[model samples]
Target: MSSTDHAAAVHQVHRDDYGSRLGMWLFLFTELILFGGLFIVYAVYRFMHQQEFHLAAQELNTTIGLINTIALLTSSMTAAMSITAMQKGNLRFSKWLIWVTIGFAFVFMVNKYFEWSAKIHHGIFPGSKDLLAKPDGEILYFGLYYVMTGLHTFHVIVGVIFFLFILRQIKQGKITSDRYVRLENSALYWHLVDLIWIFLFPLFYLIH
Candidate 1:
């Protein structure tokens, strides 16, 4: 290829990389705004119903919450390490780390499933007869709890799917040491998932 043509191609690759990163950042920003608004609503309601919110929080199993928190934090670490491994040209190890991260996500979902099952079994779910009989603050607390955590859980599922797709790309040699922006972006997304859970853990489980 001509030198001028080669230089233009390289510039295009760089531009694409920059554009991908910028796009991911913009998406994350929108996510932040969504959860930020929910947080503000939570804060306002908690302020208005401090006692009931505190009491409702007591119904949550802190132990299970702690376990899920640890799982996500560890998954975040694994996701980041996967990117580093790919950048370092350790494809096999990077793939292994991605699998590990997905495993952690599974653990989180399992725990959440059981937790929700327990709540539902106890008739504490939104709009249930038992929940409807509770004080308004307690009702609101569980409502927010279900909505926020459910949304975060959905994000976890999406992150798992993202990693699986990245794994496929790695296997096909599309994402390699020199071209791992997809992996990097997925890790950024996983970190956001973990960070949201960080806020949620304290808000829903530690309100004593």
Candidate 2:
């Protein structure tokens, strides 16, 4: 290729990368808006039923929530590390860090499973007889609990899938030191996931 043509191609690539990052940021902004609305709703209800919210929060296992928080926080770090590894041209290490992030995600999910199972076993789920018998504030608290945390759980699953795809791309030599915007975007998404849970852990488990 001629020098001028090569320069034009390089400029096009840079524009594409910039566009991709911008798109990802816009998408993340939407996610934030969604969660932000829920948070507002939560705040209003909690303000109206402070004691009940406090009591309902006590029903949650703080230890398990703490463990999950740690897992997600660690996973976020690993995700960032994976991007750095890629930028440093350490493909193998990058892949390994991604795996570690996935492993932490698994840990978080497993703890969530047990925690949810316990709640269900206690008949505390929405529409259950036990939940229906609770005070309105407690009921509302649990309702928000399940909705917000459930939504966050879905994001965690999505983040895991994104990482899985990223791992495959890395192995296929599609994602590399020169081209890793996809990985970077996925890491950003993961960080958002972790951040949402940071809010959730305190709201649902530590309020008491």
Task: Say which candidate scores most in TM-score.
Answer: 1
Scored against the true structure, residue 49 in model 2 reaches a CA lDDT of: 95
Instruction: Give the true-structure RMSD of model 2.
Output: 2.4
Error of 2 at 38 (Å): 0.7
lDDT of 1: 0.95
List candidate 1 segments past 4 Å from native. 1-15
Question: Where does model 2 exceed 4 Å of error?
Answer: 1-15
lDDT of 2 by residue, 76-156 (tens): 999999999999999999999999999999999999999999999999999999999999999999999999999999999
TM-scores of the candidates are 0.94, 0.94
> lDDT of each model, Cα atoms only?
0.95, 0.94
For candidate 2, the lDDT comes to 0.94
Tell me the number of clashing residue pairs for each predicted model. 0, 0
